[model samples]
Target chain A: MTITILFFWLSLAGTAVFAVSGALQALRNDMDIVGVSFIACVTGVGGGTMRDLLLGATPVAWVNDPTDIIVCVTFAGLTVVANKQIIGRRLDLLLWADAVGMALFAVLGAAKAQQYGAHPLTVILFGAMSATFGGIVRDVICNEIPVLFRKEIYITAALIGGVTLLLLPVGLDDAFKLSIAVVVSFTVRACSIVYGWSLPKYG
Target chain B: MTITILFFWLSLAGTAVFAVSGALQALRNDMDIVGVSFIACVTGVGGGTMRDLLLGATPVAWVNDPTDIIVCVTFAGLTVVANKQIIGRRLDLLLWADAVGMALFAVLGAAKAQQYGAHPLTVILFGAMSATFGGIVRDVICNEIPVLFRKEIYITAALIGGVTLLLLPVGLDDAFKLSIAVVVSFTVRACSIVYGWSLPKYG
Candidate 1:
């Protein structure tokens, strides 16, 4: 189905971006290869796994097939090998990747829930959860405060994307819904990153 | 089946102990009431939920049944309101409760995995994951390195208990298996806590 294809590519992009973000984070924290691989795999599938668990979709996406986890591990390995140039001097690269990954996951996650017949509100919740929880897990494991809890506008972007996907006309194609969701979500996040925009925080 | 009773009691004990541990941890970190309840619920069911997800069981246990989460939330509320002598100065009570929870989760998690037909190795892994991961999530959210990561000998205790449950004679009553597992695991942990035992960490 067109929906499946939409999810397939969006999920793929999300996984790739998430893996890079995690690997770069691990490198920054000076974690060894094992820790890097662990963080990468966790970030890569953590959201989707949580989404499926919430939906009562058994056999969590990666456990039913090790392929995605394996890919994530490989990406981590590659990042480690290219540490000096790609991850070291390019911290901004990791941030952009994280934003893009967050965008894709927000759309894809809500879409999956919709396909499973969840209500629009539930879809929005699942989408935001999928978008942000991975980064939460990653930062938490590294012993840092979660980004969402900090000044970042991460949750807002995911929520916008999820609501946008839900409000689209029913006559629209699934692919069209997914595409628009990404554009809006990614643009919001990308602008935030570039402009150093952040939500107000009490010091 | 007798196994059902074993799980019922162990799960009850697990939920209670996990709730207390979360509440105590929250109080120590100066979290407000909402944060306290959130951490408590997450710690209370985080492990078993992970176990079911890994086993491809859907709807997660608490999502399908709200009773456990409600209990955890209430415990958190009570801990916050009953703050003075019980939870404030007597951190030891919290540690003891955590030990009991670790023991129960270890036994019950492995037993459930076995009942679900997981491999022997997987049963052990899942049991350990179920027992310790809740604490890990708790600590992470509180912005501290997990007790397991630092020097508490937590993983060792959980692994010993899980393997003990797995190796118990099948002909024995499930309740007996559960009891022996608890005794072994709880004893080890209590000793470690009382004696200030810790695993060496490289700085």
Candidate 2:
């Protein structure tokens, strides 16, 4: 019961962060409010929606919980309303927040897949997907190549976090495992941003 | 053997038409050659890839057939080289060609799903998905709201075609059924475009 509560909060935070990122991107592209809202919704919940559909989970996350939509919509609206002020002053902070959200979502995805009896490899893939797919959809909607193809070690960080959770002791509590996973992913991504770490490029 | 060959030709033609649509979209967006090729590949093959992954079809379509990649790349390159001269004043023709491609792909998708022993409804959904997913991805990459959302008749046409194929008598040759399905979908879409037919809008 407690674990479920924690997960709900984590997911909410993740959604908020992703919504902001989407809104930011839309603003950068000079899209209207409707476009901003659309992008935010896609980035905030697109991955989990796909995962649920593919996994045959019923009542989909957002459909079951209207708060998910409200949260995303509110975040998007706020971001758009404050576009200039936010972009000029808090770009770095927003980036860090986005990283944290990615980490949380990645861990949550792995946990959900584990609950559904996915194998280790499948769980890892699901985690990476949950962390990255929203961003991919965002990029595609913004008419840009997916950052996954040519950006920071985004999916790699999620992969590491997922694998770490899988490798953790079986006796550990779910909350503990999830916390460790999120920490690992967040640290990796934050350091990558701070130190200019990136994956090797191949032509 | 003959049936398989026919299906192959239909799929190939569908792929080529889809590639042309993608290439033209990229040209309109003023993308470079590499970007055009990438968009063409995604728009031409993205639907089948999604279907295969969801259905757990091993090796996927293009992965199994190296020639598929060759065909896609060649078409993409050719389009880039000749777009200016060929597409200068033929936007309407391109739309019609895209409708044709959509119809063919939808029928092929229904056939493939039936081959996999899916339920009738599931088969119909797969057919629509296979026909439209590429275009959706293309729109996403081009930073446009997907035509699927705005064009209600598009998916309906695929659905109607799929149902017709499934309901047809089993004794009919596969080619005959396929031809009927394609013509039905094409006619529906063509008429829809010409007459500005659309699904009832909800306020």
Candidate 3:
């Protein structure tokens, strides 16, 4: 179906943006080329990897196809080359792209968990987890507190997307429901970024 | 037969020590009870989890049998209760136990990889990875530089164990070979601790 193809392209875009974000973080840490590539690959695949491993999905997505890994490595190369040429606003741009990818992954991860007959609560958890886990790993590897646990509207958006998909009528087309979920998720994230919204911190 | 039983016991011991070490770390970071339990479970199984996921081993060991998680939670609770009474010497004691666990994991990980028909080099890599990765995850989650990457003989000790296991004659009993590998690995790590051995830092 056309919708399936569209989802494929979007997923690849998500993987690339995530990879670039990871590579940028590695470069900031003064890592060598190999480090940058490794981090990028891990960041791109980490969330899905965690989800799959927990679900007993073996040979995970990247291991089976490898297209995602190729995309990650390619983007890492580009980020390295572009590092000196751009500064300051690059992160902001990537954050926007990351939001799109995060939203897509939220739906995809939830849907996959649902297909596997996971509990409803678990499905939502996987959605937020898959959207946010890679970034958590990236920050953790860099020896920083995970941005997810820090102030953010990130996981909230993913949760919203998952909930929306779960509540949607079964009569709706799969692709149509997924698209709606992605939009809802992306809009919340975009608004949060624009307004600098964040959840309250613990006392 | 006796060797297999001994390995089962040692693996449990390794799991407990790693959990206790993680709980102690969580307490040091002032984490809440939930965070302490979470980190403890992750640290206890993290290395083997990574090995299984990478090897496409489904239903990962911990998920198939909940005993390890129960052990982790129980130890975490004990650590929380014992925190005040055990002060400076606790870490030293835990480190010794961790070295034993690390050695056992190195041999076990390599052996599993070989069973799966992994490349010889990949077998060695998995050995070191399964030995050190739990600590790496624990450090990363706590926002500290991984002790493995820092100045230490940790991974080298693991690699030595892996190589020793691989080179052992197939005619030897599996139990004998495994025990010999563990002894070799533990001795190297013990020496490093006593003598302050470390790989050279980059210039």
Candidate 4:
């Protein structure tokens, strides 16, 4: 029960970070406040919703627990209200925060998939999905091709982190594995952003 | 076998119509030929792709049947070439064609769900999804709230059509039910467009 509670808190924090990223993207696109809030909500929870539906989970997580919605709405509202003052000239900060959120989501998604009896490959896919799908939804909503299909190492980093967790010793503490996965994902993404590292494009 | 063949043909025809609608939308948006073709492919098969993934079907339909991809691509290519001259002044025609495609996909999605042993409600939801999801994806790509969300009668019509099929007498012929459902959905959508019918909203 304690482990579950800890994981839940982590997931909520991840959602908050992703929501901010989405809000910032919408702001950059010059969307209205409503659009910003809508995009943020979709980006933060879209992947998890898809995962739950695919796994045949009933009631869906957000529908059952309104806290997720409240958190997203609050964060999105705050971003919109403080767009110019709060986010001014700090684009780099937003990117790093987003990376942290991505890492947390990847670990949480992998752990949940593992609990649901998904095979390792599927769990990895879920992890990548959790990490990248929010951005995909945001891009799609903003009328752009998803960055995942572009020249980014985003999904790949998530997969690496997920695999690390899955391969960890069975008896090791869950928190340790979770921490390692998150740190690995964040570090890889941060380095990729700083160095502009991306996957090779196919001709 | 005959029934399956009938549905297969119907779905193909639906795809073709959907491709045309997508192409028209892209043209209206002033997209280049490649962009038009890309949007067309997405609108033609996006819903079925989502449905298949949710159902855990291997090798997704388009991947399994090369012909499906061929048909979608060919239609997209043709539309791209002819869009400027042929589709630029045919908004009404595009809407009607899209209605036909929606009707066909809605029934087909329901049929597939039933085949997969989904419950009646789930089958109905699947049918509505088939009709609406492709448009949702198209609108999202176009950076708009999904037309289905804004258009009151669209999804509701599909749901009604699906439920109508579900309530048919046991052992009845599949063709009769499918034809009826398709006709009902198309009529509803066409009339809604013609009369500008919209669901009532309260502030």
Candidate 5:
């Protein structure tokens, strides 16, 4: 179906963005090329892998296909090669790309979880997990507390996007649902990036 | 059927050892009780969770059955409550318990991966994954470099045990094979602790 193809493209794009974001984090931590590649690969597939495992989808998507790994390595390699040129633009680009990846993944993850009959709350959590777990893994590996547990507006955007996906009216086509979710999530993330928005921390 | 019961006990014991080891590591980082519990839970289930996910076992064991979580919490809580009393013997106890965990998980993980028909080499790696991943995750969350990747006898011990599990001759009973693997791994670890052995590190 056309919906499948659209989701395929969205997943690929989201994966690439996540890979690049991970490589950027590696650079920040002064990890070498191998470190960059590993982080990128983990970041790209980590969320989906977790989602699939939690959903009990066997042979995990990436392990069965290997294409996702290939995509991750390619993007990470590109980041390593372009390291010198990306410094000044790195922070800005990283946030934008992370937001894009989060939007796409949040939608896709929620959809997959729903298809698997996850509780609505679980589906929303899956969306957030898919969008942000890679970053958490990356930060943890690099000895930084996970950004997700920090005061960022990070998980909020994913949760909102997931809820939006679930609330699609009965008659809306899948394509319409997907695009609207991506846009709404991306916009929220962008606003957060631009305005330094964050959730309040409890003492 | 007999083998199932044996492995059930092995898995529980391994899970407990991993939990205790994680709580000890959390203590080293000056984490509070909640932090200890969290780290212990992650360490206890992290490897099996990864194994099940990688093997496509749905609902991951812990999620479907809260027993593992309960065990992890109970052990962690005990560690917290007994903090003052156990410190003197912790070093010796930690090493021995960790060895037991690594031994059991390595055997179980390799066997499971083999059951799924993973290549021999991949099975060996899976065993190592089962043994050391929890510690790696534990250290990462604690903002420390993983001990497995350092100049420790840690991963080497797991790798050896995994390979031993794989190379068992065709006729050995499963129980005998499991015991040998665990013993071989524990002995190697014990020697390392007694002799201060470590793998050579590259600059």
Candidate 6:
């Protein structure tokens, strides 16, 4: 029961931060409040929606329980209100929040897929997709190249986390395993950000 | 039984034409052969996938039956082989084929949603999404503004078709109603292409 409650709050936090990141992007592009909210909501739920759709899970997460959408709209409004304070540092803050959200969702997505009996390869794919696809959609909507397809070591971080989770001993407590996975994913992403690490581009 | 076969063939044709359109765009962008095929396959199935996901129809059409993917890949290859022959008129051909595909899919999407007991408004939304999302994904992957959001009369055409189908007498034959809806959508889109008709832009 405690573990379930912990996951619920963590998922809410992840949704809120992702919403803020999307809203910041929309504001940067000079979109109005409606566009900002739309982007925010889509970014918050997009990854899990994609995962559920691929796994034949119906009524998606948001449609079944709209807490995610409500959180998205609330955070989007908050971001707009706080716009002035974060003006110059918006991009930096967005990246950090996104990293945290991505890390959390990566493990969560893999866990959900595993419960649904997806193949091991599919679990890893869903993990990376749930971590990166929201940002990809946000960038695409803003008419930019998706960061996932860029040279950034983004999806790789999620894949590493997923593999780590799958490789853990079955005897370990679920919560402990999940915590380790999230930490591993976040550390890789944080290091990449601070060190400007990237994969080599094709010639 | 005959109606089912007609719908099946129409769906295949729509998939093929959409794939061709996506491959042409990738080729114009100088994408490699693999990239072209990837874009083609995504574009061919993207719209229907979006509709199915939103309507809580899982295992999506392509996953349940791989026929659509097969058709998309075959058409992508054919487009590559015919590249030189259609170089100069590629854009025109793509637009025409896209219009037909969009019209066919719009009615089909609406019909599917109706069968699933979706509300009228939801049915119409799914119809427009099914008609335009493939092109939207294709443009996004290529880092261009989606034509659906351009001033073009794209979604409007699909909406009109969906409403037409819904308003038809309940006594009408299913195939006849679908045929009429497809024609209406196609006519609207064809006129927009020929005369450059567009929606009014925001001031």
lDDT of 5 by residue, B95-138 (tens): 67778898889888888877777767567667877887787788
Q: For each candidate in the order shown, give its overall lDDT on alpha carbons.
A: 0.79, 0.78, 0.79, 0.76, 0.81, 0.82
DockQ of 3: 0.15
**Residue B157 displacement in candidate 3 (angstroms):** 13
Candidate 5: the clashing residue pairs are none
2 or 3: which has the higher lDDT?
A: 3
TM-score of chain A of 4: 0.90
Considering summed lDDT, which 10 consecutive residues are worst modelled in model 4 chain A?
A58-67
Model 3 clashes, total count: 0
User: Mind giving the per-residue lDDT tens digits that candidate 3 earns over B133-161?
Assistant: 88778887787676554344777788788
**Which CAPRI level is candidate 1?**
incorrect
**For model 1, what is the error of residue B174's alpha carbon versus the real structure, in angstroms, after optimal superposition?**
15
Clashes found in each candidate (C-alpha, N, C closer than 3 A): 0, 0, 0, 0, 0, 0
Which tens-of-lDDT digit does each residue in B62-131 have in candidate 4?
8867776677778878777776577546566667767898899989998888887776766776687688
lDDT of 6 at B42: 97
Q: With candidate 3 superimposed using the best TM-score fit, by how many Å does residue B73's alpha carbon deviate from the native?
A: 17
Winner by lDDT between candidate 2 and candidate 1:
1
Residue pairs of candidate 1 with colliding backbone atoms:
none
Q: Measured by C-alpha RMSD in angstroms, how accurate is candidate 4? A: 8.3
Query: What does candidate 3's lDDT look like per residue over A76-104, in tens digits?
Result: 88887887776566667557756876888
Across the candidates, what are chain A's individual TM-scores?
0.92, 0.91, 0.89, 0.90, 0.93, 0.93
> Chain B vs. true chain B: TM-score for each candidate?
0.91, 0.92, 0.90, 0.91, 0.92, 0.93
- Candidate 2 lDDT by residue in tens digits, A46-130: 7776777667774355532457667877998898777767767545655765688789888889888998999989999998888
Question: A22-120, model 1: which lDDT tens digit per residue?
Answer: 888877776656456667877887888788777777666554355666678788888888887664464677778789999999998888888888999
- DockQ-wise, the better of 4 and 5 is 5
Candidate 5 chain B — worst ten consecutive residues by lDDT sum? B146-155
Worst 10 residues of 2 chain B by lDDT: B144-153
lDDT of 4 by residue, A40-103 (tens): 7777777777767667774456543556656776888887777668556435655765787888
lDDT string, candidate 5, A78-127, tens digits: 98888888878876777777889989999899988988888999999999
Question: Candidate 5, residue B102: CA error in Å?
Answer: 8.1
**Candidate 3 at residue B180, lDDT?**
94
